[model samples]
Every structure is written in C-alpha cells, then in structure tokens.
Target chain A: MAESMTETEQRPSGVPYPGTPEGRRGTGDPGFAPHDGQEAPELLERSRALVDPAMRAAVESLPASMRRIARYHFGWEHVDGSPAAGHAGKAIRPALVLAAAAALGGPAARAAAVPAAAAVELVHNFTLLHDDVMDRDPTRRHRPTAWTVFGDADAILAGDAIQALALRLLAEDPHPAAAPAAARLADCVMELCAGQHTDTDLEHRAPEEVTLDEVLAMAEAKTGALLGCACALGALYAGAGPEEVAALDGFGRQAGLAFQLIDDVIGIWGEPLRTGKPAGADLAARKKSLPVVAALVSGTPAAAELAALYGKPYITGDSEGIARTALAVERAGGRDWAQTEAADRMARAMQELARAIPDPEAAGGLLALAEFVTRRSS
Target chain B: MAESMTETEQRPSGVPYPGTPEGRRGTGDPGFAPHDGQEAPELLERSRALVDPAMRAAVESLPASMRRIARYHFGWEHVDGSPAAGHAGKAIRPALVLAAAAALGGPAARAAAVPAAAAVELVHNFTLLHDDVMDRDPTRRHRPTAWTVFGDADAILAGDAIQALALRLLAEDPHPAAAPAAARLADCVMELCAGQHTDTDLEHRAPEEVTLDEVLAMAEAKTGALLGCACALGALYAGAGPEEVAALDGFGRQAGLAFQLIDDVIGIWGEPLRTGKPAGADLAARKKSLPVVAALVSGTPAAAELAALYGKPYITGDSEGIARTALAVERAGGRDWAQTEAADRMARAMQELARAIPDPEAAGGLLALAEFVTRRSS
Candidate 1:
C-alpha cells in the first residue's frame, strides 16, 4: 500500500498565524469527498453517537474507586463528580475504526466493532493519563490533567484500570475477531510504553545526542501505533483478510505520521484558543520534537544557533527566548521540512488506503478522517 | 465450597523467633501431603520449570528499551543487562494455577494453563514495580528496587509493558479457555488497581481513622483477588463448571487472606535475617498492615499507646521506638487476633478445596502449596 491517490485529495490546506513560518501557509486542501458528500465532523459525530453507549457502559462498569477519576478524564463529569457534556477529544481514533470497518464490511461490521472502538479510545486515554504523570504535564483538553486533580497515584491507578477495562471489553465480546483484536491492541500498548520510555530517555540527553531518525521512530511508536492498531482492529471485525488488515494498518500509520508532523508544527505555531495548549510550549521545554531535531541536524548556521539556545536551560516566562528559538528553527529550514514531510506521509497514507479499498466512494469516510486529523489544528 | 476438609490438613505449623508472641509460636502443622509426598518446594520448582520458558519468551518479546529495565526488575539480568540467575520470586502464583488445574483435570489441564500461569506472574511483577514507585520503597527481593536502579519513568514504563505483555500472552494463546481467562485476569488487574488505590489513600490518613474491616477488604483486594483469579483461570482451563470454578476461586481467596494476615504479622515481628527486610520497616513507615489496623481499633489501653506512638513521625534507626511499638501491638492483641483470623481463613479455604475436589489425594499439591506459603516466613 504505497502512492496512487491524486495529490489534490491527499494534501492539507495550511492555516497561517503569527508563528506560522513562510513556505508553509495555505497549502492545497486534501480534497476528499466524504461519504454522502459529508465532512470529518459529521463522520466523527456519527461514530461517536454509535460508540458512546459502549464507552459509557465500560466507564460505568468500573469500580467506584477508579470510576470517579475516569469519569473526569473522559470529560463526562466535572472534577466535583457532577455530570458534564463530554469533550473527550474529537473521538478521532474510534472514528477511524468505524470508518475502516464501514469501508470494508459496511454498516454491520462498523456496528460489530463498537466494543473494539471503545477499547481503542480507552487505550488512548490510558496513555494520556500515565503520560501526564510522567511528563508532569499540568493541563489537557483545557482542564487540569487527572494527576493534578486526583494526585499521581490515583491517576496511575485509573490508567491501569482503564487499560484492563479496554482488554476486558474485547475478551468478553462474543465476536470472533475480538481475541485477535485484543492481542493486537495489547501489542500496541507495549509499543506505546516503549515509545514513551524512549521519549523520556531522549529528553534527558543533549540535543546533539538525539537523532532525527530516533525522534521519528519515537513519534511513530508513541502516536502512530495506536492509530494503526485501531484501523487494523476495524479490518479484523470486518472479516478482512490479513493483507487488507495490514494495508489498513499501514494507511493509519502513515496518516498518523503526517498527523504527528502537523501536530508538532502546531505545538510550535498553533493558536492557544484552538489547541488548548500554549503556543511554543514544546520549544519552551526544550522538547526534542521532530522539527526541532530536523533543524538541529540541518548543518546550517541557524542550526548551530538553535543548538546553542537549546543547550542553555529554559527559564519560566521566557517568551522573548521562545520567539527567538522558534525563529532559529524556521531559519534552519525546520518548518518547511515538516510541511513537506507531512505532505509526503499523507501521500503514502493515500496509497495504502487506495491499495486496501480501490473505490474512492467506499473509502470516503476514512479519507475524510485522515485529512481531518492532519488539518485539525492548522 | 465451605468446611469439608480435615482440620489437621489445613493448619500451618509455626516457627518462632524472639519477636514471635506466645499464642502464635507453634500452631499445629497442616498434615495433607503433597503429590508423591513431594511437598511445595518440589511442586513449585517443577512448575517453575514448566512456566519459565513462557515467561522468558514474553519478557524477551518486549521492545529493546523496555526489555532492559524489565530484565533487571525480574532479576534475570543486572542493571547493566548482563545475565544473572533469575530470582523473580518463589513462583507461588503460577504454582497455584498449575496445582488447581491438575487437581481438576490432571496433567493436560496443567500443561495447557502455562501461558495463563506466566501471565499471572507478570501481572504480579507489574504491580510490584508500580507499587515500589508510589511507595518510594528502596528495595525489593533483597535488591535495589527497579525505580531506584532505573529512574522512576523507566521503571513505570517497564511495568506498563510487562502488564501489556501479561494480557498479550493470554490473548495469543490458542486454547479455548484463553479468552475467559484473559478477561478474568484483566478483571483481577482492576481489583488490584483499586486495592492499591485504597492502600495509598489509607496510608495518608490517621491510623485511628482506619477500620479493621476496611483494611481486611483492602488486603483481600490487593493480595487475594489475583490468587483467586489464578485458580479460577486454572479451573476454566480444566473445563470445570461454574460452581467448581467458583469454589476453587473461594479456596484461593481464603488462602490468600490467610497469607496476607501472616505476611502483615511478619512485617511487624519477623527476624530481618529471614524476611530480607527490616522487621520494623512496616511499623516505621506507619503502614496500615492488617495487624496494625486490628490493633488500632482494638479499644484496649495498649491501643492508645500504639496510636500515640504511631502519631509521632518515625525517625530512622530508632530501635527503642520500634521495640515499644511492636510490644504495644502485641499487648493490644493484634498478634493474637491475626493468628486466630488466619486459622479461621485456612479452615474456610479447606472447605472450599474439599467442596471442589473431594478426593484429598487429588488435592494434595494445592494443599501443600497453600500451607508452604503460610509457613515459609514463619
């Protein structure tokens, strides 16, 4: 599954802001004609409507001790435990699962994969909870991270229980595909863990010690693996054979990589109002994100300057320093490289999607999703 | 599954040290002999032989970054990653799984349950790794804890991977019972997380605010739940009916409670030489172990003294304070209550085992293993 979809349907339209660098603004839209001529939000909303019951049931089934924290994390309850309208992300991963199922096996397979979709979402949130604790991240989705609210031990426990719940959902399912889905999901979890370990390990070393390849691999494992697994699971539920499953997985993984590249770009230039995180926070923390690594190894004068700036410790409220650092990275060709890399990855993703489902009409929902995630915070 | 086995076969013989109180010094020995009169050590050793490869394969399958830390945690390799003779534990949990399977369906059942057995052990180690981090414990199995050897982040990631591996093993097994067993194992993990959550929550509160019943429930959840699940999984593999599986689960849970009660007692009164940890370490940390809570709520005069002593923060190397604290617990009848409670639990366990497997000879291995754990630290 590797480049036959038209460039117009696979390219993202870039949004320019104050921090958006030259050569990256207003790129062409990935002109996907979604199902029923619908968009990603519609597909996501439909998927959410179908998957919400299963997700809520899984959360409700948790023991009281863990249920409270999970409820808050999922945005279904306030910190005080009162009900709230859920704001649990765009529900993108589950949408991917449902879309992939629909593409291969129609509505029936999509419905059959509900438990698995919920399981995938649960895994994503589980990693989020643990990652917040490990990274000492203070906020997520415009609220205090669970560890900051319930304390680290409780947050960790909640995450542990959620992971179990995820597996239990599949294990208890009568669907024949459930067991293989579980094994694949569990394997994804280990990859996620290893990715996190590498991320943390890399963070402690000098910027020069970290390679672009290493950071890319870390991103793939950390971010791409789950997306791949979700799509693979959807294929399994649809009774798609091994080749199709692998192709779908590759599609998701490539899209996920493009998603990461765009996400990293957003981490540097995204609007706070849209992204729910402060602009340039990653740079402020001296995080060795993909663009930063790319710029560091560019062998240019600006790369040296960027390296020197990163060598020094970041101080709080150093907005001036952050601005200068962002400039150095741009001058070192980071932003342009990231934009090009994202387009390349999305093209690869389109190839995989086309290989798996040759008809554009059948693949509309998935095509919309991949484009949506890549363009989400632009 | 209640009260049918002979009393002599369920009671554990006691070993006494200077700290052992008068009432608990030499309780009568359990008289049920092991298969071929081999006893627990032989059974455990044999089971270890059977399950070790599966455990090793699971660990080795981990990604390179996590594998190093997991290897160190399992005592299979040193911190530097060179090989070492494995000292993972006594292999008790897996042994129980094998024993229960054999009791129900003989050799084939036991053999089929190997992956489940390895999965259980992995879950146990995963919990240990996280608990050590949360508790900030400096040692485990007489060596530096994983969190201390690697940083907290790496240890946590390793634990996370091991847990995923645990479920993955069960998920990958082709046996008919694997799905149910994985679901059961995952459910136990949730219970384990909740138990740990309660334990951490209780640790931050005043000792007097804690109740005996609360601690008892916590102990059962933390220690007994997995043991019960292990037995139930074994019974599932053996094709046992629901009633028989429930009985075996009951047997394991009761025995687990007894194990915890004695472990708590040992935490407060055993010789450090045998226990491999300081005798008063739990007391020094003001841990709300089973006996400690029992003593605190005793309503005896010594209970007040113990509470007041526990109220003051412990200074390291205060041998006099530790001695006084141990004596206070004893005088308040914590020791006596624990011994009596353990015996009652053992009796209940015997009843469950007899109900599930009426033939004493067939049940010999399980009986011996249960008695061995209860007596090993005595």
Candidate 2:
C-alpha cells in the first residue's frame, strides 16, 4: 500500500473535512459557508428553504407516536415535544438534486424537483436514525441521538416510518419522474443497508483481514450511493437521457467519495472543538477508518508501529498515545495518501460533471457544491 | 370492558385460529387446509405458488450481506447458508390481494396484481424481521429468527432492505395502480410502525393502566392496516372505484382484527404442542394482549383478581401459576369477550366484503379467506 505515498509526500496543514456539529456527517452540509464566492452555500440555503416545508409536511403525516421521535431527530422539536430552532443539516443532498436539475433542464426542472429533493433529505435522515442505533452513536448534530433519547425500538421504528414517508413522497408526486425516482431511491436504500452491514461487519473483523478495496467499496456504498442517486433522480426529473443521468450519478459518487476521504482524514486530525469530539475519537473507538487502515497496510516500519498501537484498546485520556499513533500514521504516509486520493476523486467528479453538462457555466453550481463538499470538511 | 353474560358465555373448543408453526403471525395464512370446502386455503396455496417466485426473485436481488438474513427469515435457507424446505407462511396477504382483484375484475386483473401481491408480502415479511429484532423474538417460522442467527444489526439491515425492495417492486411495476399501491403500502408501513410502538409501550405499562380500546386500536394499526392495504392494493389494481377500494380496506381491517382476537385467545388457551409455546405463554410473558387488556379493563370482581395475578411476573416452570392466571382472565370474561368481539368483527368484515362485491359467487374466495382468518385462529 506504500507505493508513491511515502513520508516525503505531504499536504498542507489545513484541508477541508466535513464540519457537522455531531462530529459525523449524515444528512446535510453542516455549517460551512460560501468560499471563493462560490454559490454552493447560497444554493444549499435555497435548497433547505425549499425542502424544509415539504419535509415538515411529510413528517407531520407520520403517526403521532412516531412523529415525536422523528421531529426530535430532525432537530425540529425537543425531547418534550416543544418546538426548537431546527438544526437539520445543510440540505446538501437536496441542493445536489436541484442543482443537477437546473444544470440540465434549467429553473423549471429545479422547481419541479422539490418533492424529490425533500424525499432525498428524508431518506438521508432515515438512514441517520438507523445508523445511530446500529453504531450505538450517542450524539448527532451536537445533541443526544434519537436512540439515546427515545430508546432503540422507537429509534428503529422512527427510521422505518421516515423511510416509508420518503418513498411515499415520490410515490404520491404527480411528476412523471416520480415512479422512477421512487425506484431509484428504493434501490439506494438497499445499497445503504448493505453498506451499513459491511461497515459493522468490518468493524468486527481483524484489521489485517480487511483490504483497502473492501473499505473503499463500503465507503462508496455507505456514503456515495445516496449522493449519486440524488443527482440521478434530479436528472430524471429534468428529462435527461440515460447517459446524462449516469454521468451525473458518476459525478455525485466521486464527489461523495472525496467527502468521505476528507471526513476520515479529519476524524484523525480535526480540531476537537469544531468536530465536537475528542481528537482522534475514531482512533479511540478503534474505528477502522480510511487513514488508519491505509497506514496499517502501508508496509513500512511505521505501519507495524501503527498496527501495534491499534491492536491495543484505547485508554481514556491517553492523548500522548493518540499523538504517537497519529505520528506513526503520518510517518507511514496515511495522511498524504488520503489527501492525494481525495483531490484525485474531486478531479474525477468534475470530469463527470463536465461530461454530462459540457458547458462550464451550466455546471458551475454543481461544480461549486462538489468543491464545497471536498473542502475543509465536505 | 366486559358487560356480557360474564363467565357463562363460552366458546366451544377447536375454534379455528391462525395455525402457523410459529407462535406469532406476520406474513402468512399458515398451514390450515380448507374448511367446509371453503376456497381460502386453496386460494392461499395458489397465491403462494404465484407470489413466492416473485418474492424469491426480489429477495435474491438484495445484497449478499442482507440476502442471507432475508433468505433465512423467509425459511428459504438455513443458518449455515444451506437451503431449507421453505416453510414461508401461507400467503394470506398475497392471497388477499389476488382474491380481491379476482373478485372485482376477473383473471386479467388478478394477473396484473401479482407484483402488488408480492409487494404486500414483502412488506409483511419486512415488518416481521424488524419486529423480531425489536421484540427480541428468538424464533420465527419454527426456526431461530434472523436476529438470533445474524445479530441485531444485520437483521435490522435486512429488514430495511426488504422494505425498500417492497416499495421498489411497486415503483417498477408498469401497472397503472402501482403508484397508488405504493402510496397506500407506504402509509400502511407508517401505521405499522405506530402500532408496534403502541404494542411495546403497552407491554411496559401496568395492567390496570391499559385499556381495551387502546389495545384494539393498536391491533388495528399494527395488524389490520397491512391486511387492509393488501386488499386496497388489490382493489386499486383491479381498477375499482374509491367506494370499492374503501369497502375492501374495511373488510380486510375487520378480518384482521378478528384474526388478532382469535390469535390472542389461542395465546391463552391453545395447546402447547400446537402453539410451539408453553400453555399461557403470553400470560407468562405478561403480554398485554387483546383479551388480557379486556379483562384488566372489565368492571367485574374477577377483573380485580386477574389484575392482581398480572401484577407479578411469571416464574419459569410455573405452569400452575400460568393456569391460575389464565383462569382469572377467563373468569373475568376475557375469553368470551374476545370470542364475541372476533365474531362481531367477522360479521362486519362480511358486510364490507358484500358491499364491495354484491355477488356472493364473485366474492367466494375473499369470503373463504376472511372465514379462514377468523376461525379458531387468524
């Protein structure tokens, strides 16, 4: 694994990683702002404004028993059922949908894709709820996870209901693309389930037994599939042809991979105050994240040292040990590998976007969104 | 609360209840044969023959990680990845879909409805998988449940995937009714979630704090909603009018309640050999089943005694205590109330079926299915 990624290769200190409040990325773009005068943040804001009402209406249709759990999960309500300033994610998926729609078919297509946008957002949250339960995640968006507050059964039920509601939105839409969108979205859910299974299954396996390819496939399914489907659905709504839809899907998938790579890098190196967790929290949890796995398989002297550190369970407040492990990985070229791979993936994403839209101006919104996603925490 | 002839009202032995090999019901009509030359079992058999292939094909489409769990849950495969003599329950929901279609629009409609039939069955099994996880059920279809074999996370993921597959089937179908069916099925899923929440929540509540109406509504939501959706989907596929679809939904809902009522009675009184559980197993588990809740809420002297017995948890090997508890519920008129209510629900189901299809000959299959469901067990 230590091919060109040797200790001599280096990246700048500050790289973009996902900056979700929960220390993890799920449904949204989080709190990132416009950079380099890009329209990505503005586009995301517009997407959220458009999608939130539809999402709320869809959530309202859930049975009262499940509605409370869902509302709280969405950051729309407190545990006591009182209203709250919603901190629902930055509508990255919805923004992708609308941007893709507009890129190919202009504003009318964007307008027509609103329900599908909401549907994608709902699906994202549904996965978040279930993933929290499966991973036993205690917090999300800097608050107690739905499972922690409502218990496993309720969390699971709420996720199930939300997923149903998501597909129902597409199923009920009068748009000609609705059925196809539902089908695509449903396919994405299966991919996601399989991805989550692979994820949890990998966590149980010995680190040496897992390949980098396996990790990449898992990340692609877990993180890339939905993003790709969101763009694909938008293309369908825009009356795009098969090739165009496929290209847009490719674009989103590569962008999503870039996002995961950056996110994983940050998990090892991001500031504790920003990520809302202790530095190297993934390391402390013994999570087989991208860089850690990359470092372990690097076949260098430091790879052995990193593996030795990973073999032992993390001790609480063992900052010195964490620092040593981080140094070992850096020496083994894991950080450099991740950053290089992320940049490569982003380049591929842009190529795919251009392949479908040819015109740079038409693809600018999507291009900006993709860049924002890869920057300092996608 | 019971205000009937008290303990004087008695049901004869051998009342037909759902005779699934598993103690609980979810997907199928189970292993009962035709009664009085009724076509219910025959219809279920044919429906299974038609729908199983579609169901299997859809399940085969799941990712390998989830496919094994689903195959095992459906009793198509064993824990070690070996094939089993498939004991997938009687295709009651699929049978309902086909029978309702056949009743309203003949053979063409029935054939067109096959995909919907499979979709309904998939949804049913999806719920079964998740319910097994949430309820910590050890066995299903007389085998170890998916969760017991694969662990909680995999089972949950498989369930999630199966639900998506169900919606995908509808979404991909070219039939005009597909969208409406997906919408209704999605709504039913939400209702099922709410119902399951109520079921678990009620189980945690004190016996005296629970009410009969609450249990009834829960049963309707949890059990009846899916059945109703199955029938409604069938109706939609048949190009039936709103009134016909509504009537079929009502018909299935009432029949499902009857099914639950009979199932609850079987819980209290069925032979251990038949139920694959100890006598009064539900009582031992302190489940707030329909009859038990009715007894608790009954304003009778025996109600107090039954409540007192229910206040304490049952000990393992305490058959005598279980018997005593069963008798207390019986004396509180729980058995009579359940049987009478089931019969009444069956009558209402018949009324709705008649309204939907005035010609008795045209409705024979549905009539038989409803009768089969409500008989001693549903």
Candidate 3:
C-alpha cells in the first residue's frame, strides 16, 4: 500500500484502489491493484471519533424540540428521545476537514480545526434535512427521513437551526481564522441554495431545453461548493495562506464533481440494497441526473428515446418503464461518458492536491478519501 | 412636542400618542394628548436611508436567481425585474439598532453600526419570508408575499440565503465586535426556530391544553429575542460595556413584547384597510394568539362562548364565525388585558432604556419608536 501511494502512475485511474468488492470492480487500468481496505476505514473511524463529540455538543445546544429533531436526524436518538444505535452518515466531509488541516499545519492544527470539522458536518446535515423535505424523499441512510417523522415544519426548522448553529460555533471560536471561516461557509450555503433552486427549476423544463453546462454548474454549486468550503475552512483554521486554502478548495471541488459523476452512475445501475434506496429511484422519478442529461444531449437514437420517455409523466409503479429508460441512457453512452468524466475529474483532483502539497505522504489520506467517495456504490 | 417628550408621565397608557386618526381613538386616560406624528416618521425615514444601502449591497452579493428573489422580497424590484415602489416594511428593527448605537455612543457610532443595522434588518426580513410560507399567508405589506409569487421552495431558499448573508455581512465587517455580533445573530435565529416549532406544535393541540406562560415564552423567543439581539449588536458595535449592552437588550425585549401584544390586538380588532389583513383574520384561522389565550382563561361568559367556538374546526371563509369570536375575545377583556400588558411593557422598556442611557434626550428616538410600534393601528 505504501509503494502504491508513492507510485502514482500505477494507481487505479478511476476506481478506489482498495479491496472492497465494489472497488475491485474497476475497469482493467494497467498496473492497478487493489490494496487492503483497512487504512481508509481506520482513518474514517478516527475522524469520526475526533469529530463526533463536538458535533453532538453543537446539536445539544439547540432548544428542546429542535434538539430532539436534530439528534434524531443525526441518528443519535429515537423518535421517542431514547438513545438509538442508528446509522449516522459516513463522516466523509469532516474527515476531509481534519485531513486538510493536518496536511497544512500538522497535528495541533488538525486539533484546532475540530470546531470547523463539526461545523461543516452540521452544514452538510442541514442540507440533507432540507433536501429531503424539498425533494419529498421519504428515506435517508436506510431510515425514514426527518421530515417524514417530525413533519415538514419541524424538519425544516431543525435544518434552519442546525445551519445557524454551524455559524455560531465558528463565530464563537477563539481562533483568529473564525471570522473568515464563517464568511466562507455562509457563502457556500448561498451557493448551495442557488444550485438547489436551479436544479428544481430544471426539473420543470423540457429535457431538450436544459444544457449540460447548466447541469454541471448546478452540480458544482449543490455538491462541490460545500465540499470545497469544508477543505478551505480546515486550511483556514490551520492558518494556511490564501493560496494554499484555494488549492485545497480546488482539489475538493474536482473530487466533489467526480463523486457526483460516480453517484449519478450508481443511481442508474447500483444495487438498491447497497444504495439503500429503491431500485432505479432516480430513473423512476425521471430525475435529470448527470448520466440522464448526458444521454438526452448525446444526439444518438437512444438519446431521442430516452428524452421521449422522460417527457412522459413518470408513474410511481412503472418499474418496467424506469428500467427501460435506464437501458436507453446506457445505450446512448451516458454511463461510459460519466465513468470517463469521473476518471478525468479524479486526475484533476490529484493534480490540485500535488500543487497544494508536493509531498506524496501528506496527500495520502486526502487521496484515499477522494477514492472512497468515488468508489462507494452507495 | 418637546415639552411632551419630557412630560413622560402624562403620556397615553396604552395607545401611541401620535396625531394619527387611529391614534386619536385611544381610550381616555386622563391628561393624555396626541403629539404630532412627524418625529417618528422622520426618524424612520432617516434610519431607512442609513440602512438601505448596506442591505442592498448585502443582497446584491447573492448569486443571480437568489439575488432576484431577495430583491423582489425586499420590494426593490417587480416580479418582472423592473424597479418597484413597493413598501418594504416599517424598518423598525434596523431603526432600533441604529438608535441604540447612537444612544450609547454618539452619532458617529450610529454610522459604525450600519452593518449591524443591515444585519438585523436582513434577519427580520428572513423571518418574515419564512413566517409567510409557514403560515401560508398570501399578503405582506399590501402585496403578494414572496412565497405566493415565487413558489414555496424559492421563497424558502431565498430566506435561507438572506439569513446566511446576514451573518456574512457581520463576519466580513472589520469591526472588533463582528464576531460577537454574528454569534448573537445566529443564536437569535435558533431561538426563532424554537419559537416557531412551539407555535406549530400549539396549533395541533387544543387551546385549553396550552398555558399562557408557554405562549409568552414562545412570543419572547419568536419576537423579543431578535429585537434584543438587534439592540445588543448595536450597543456592542458602539463599544458599550456588557452591562450597558444587557440593559439595551432588556429595553428591546420589553418593547418587543409590547409590539407583539399590540400586534395581537390589531390582528383581531383593527380595521382591515389599516392593518392590510382581513379583520379578525387571527380568529378566522383560530390561531393560538396571545389575546385568544388570555380570553380563554378569563372565566367570563364571553370566554366560555369563545372556547366553544374555538373547539370546532375552523372552516375557511367563515367570516361570520371569525367576527363573533373576535367580539367574544374583546368582551372577555382580552383586548383590555393586552392593552394593559403592552403599557406595562412600555414602562419597563423605558426603565431599561434609562438604565442604559441616563439622558432622556438620547433615549427619545427609541422611546418614540417603541410607542410607534405599540400604538400604530397596523
């Protein structure tokens, strides 16, 4: 594994080079070999251990009802306020925050970035709670979504409270970097809102009228902005210069785009059990996901068929139609295009990381996180 | 008018002592006389001029679609993107922010408080936008509410964006007080969410099951917290000590409570044209407003009748039922109680203002604004 980390040219081109079943399913890129997956999971566990207490403390600061809703949303409590061993998220963003801090300013800097890591995690969950309500998605992380359990108003309010708490945490931090960190996070939130607005607006338009560039911009705002902010915040807290912070932000943005591309592919073809969603859920809803959009604009015969299918009203029980649409999207080369784009983005991400931290040892954990995000079937 | 400003004891106990037609209808408290309304309007105009440019600049920083929605919400543009002459709001919160700053420090301090003033105004409008969506209110400031025109998702997203922008403005300010200002603003937002959560929860339960203390706490959270934060932020910006800031916060809190009490009275009894809402609209929705809660506990025959009426489902378009309920609330002394409470709060507000700023001349604008808020028919 150490040799593979040093030998960047021999690393997997697109997929995670770790011995998970899904990661091992990579296209046969030359000289690529799957290493044991122990390192990534251990790092993730460490990050969670480091960040969870602060995150929990932030959620606990919310008023009673909101605190209950937030705790439940974080999988820390049951609906009845009893402790529950539910699945929290993978803590990927917080991991990136800590890793970036450590990369820039070593261990003490990483510790100083703990509040920022928790803040980013809070912002991420805030988006999830609101997104679930806005999209009317009933489930998340294999559990009923907060909106479904707490009712829409409470869910939305919880999201709002969490977002405020994120900023409050940063603003109250004694670190000099706190002010700029808060400003950056707030800017990212506005971008997320703009992206979500554009996404919903696109859904109301004809498939043929939407441009790929618009979709990509929306994806960057909706997904990449927060990830970039997470990394930038960590660097800022580490007392890194603006250029270093910007470099980390760029790295995270490319990785985020790659993550979204792979996620779009998985949405079409991933096993529902692994993804923890209904089979072909995106296609069933005729969602304008990246792969589907690529297909609709491909100008192939299958592209026309896919567009026609998307134009029709998507009925809830029409699994057959959904499967057919997914097939048409793949036939138009949307799946392959997304896969290639993901690989390209991954390469770009590595380039940015190298520019920011020339030492391969410092970049190892961030690279592993990027691979983990892209390689996850879920 | 100057003599009357010094003759505080002879001021009207409940209503505003400004020379408006509605103000002239005040109950005959001995030796009370309406002063010319010119001072409050002039002060409001000055405050708006001071705060609007900063507010506009903050909104302009948002991305395009969100910027458009926020501008529209602020009455700066028509839905078609043309400039409009729509009334934004009374700008009361921003006025309080500046007044508090000037009262603590000199006029130069008011200029220094511009960002804080803008921040508080943004927070105020953020709450209004969300409240309209949550209550499904169709009209605000004599025009269609943002949610009605822009759709619920956009209105909500716009509100979220504006809120983030408020904190961003504070964080970006070069003032030493920016960090604490941002923290205070964010904390107030959480309280607002908690209050809103309790409010919605109350709506789902029988009125008899809710206590006046609970309702008052909700009101303080929903209304008084932000007002207090605004004043505290202003005082903080003016470099006031903690005790002075706390006193200003107390002043704003009592004024805010008085504001809510008068708003409840106006909701049920004010003229529709003046209030810009249907007469007895609160009764029409059977909202658990403070006056209604007071009347429910009054133990009068009218209170019993009101309780019986409230026990039934509130049918939409039941204007007759709403009017009768309003009459019952008044007959049970709810109106009288709210009026007395408002007067008591105003007295407390004055006391706190005196503690914060011993000179009555410095306190004149805040006093006038408080009287205006509680006294205005709208």
lDDT of 3 at B134: 83
Per-residue alpha-carbon lDDT of candidate 1 for residues A1-378, written as tens digits (9 for 90 to 100): 002112322455332111222422233322453447447999889989998899999999888999999999999999888999857988899999999998999999999999999999999999999999999998888788999999988998899999999999999998999999999999999999999988998999999999999998998999889989999999999999999999899989988999898778778765566667677888988989888999999999999999999999889999999999988988998877887888888878877877788776677788778888886653
Which residue pairs in candidate 3 collide? none
Residue B192 accuracy (lDDT) in model 3: 94
**Which candidate wins on TM-score?**
1
Total clashing residue pairs per candidate?
1, 17, 0
- Looking at candidate 1 chain A, the ten consecutive residues that score lowest on lDDT are A1-10
Per model, the share of native interface contacts recovered reads 0.85, 0.90, 0.87
Q: How high is the CA lDDT of each candidate model?
A: 0.85, 0.83, 0.81
* Pairwise TM-score winner, candidates 1 and 3: 1
Candidates in order, TM-scores: namely 0.93, 0.91, 0.91
Global Cα RMSD, each model = 6.6, 7.1, 6.0
Q: Write the per-residue lDDT of candidate 3 for residues B1-378, one digit (tens) a residue.
A: 123222322233443323232333332422123233325777789899989988988998999999999989888898999999865888888888888888788788899999999999998888888888887889877778998999988988898899899999998998988888899889999999999999888888897888888888998899888888888988998899999899889888888888888778777775456566666778878888988999998889998999999998778888788878988998888877886777777778867877887755566677677777766644
Give the per-residue lDDT digits (tens) of candidate 2, residues A83-135.
99966867799999999998899989999999999999999999999999999
Give candidate 1 misplaced runs (Cα > 4 Å). A1-10, A13-30, A35-38, B1-30, B35-38
Best by DockQ: 2
Error of 1 at B91 (Å): 0.9
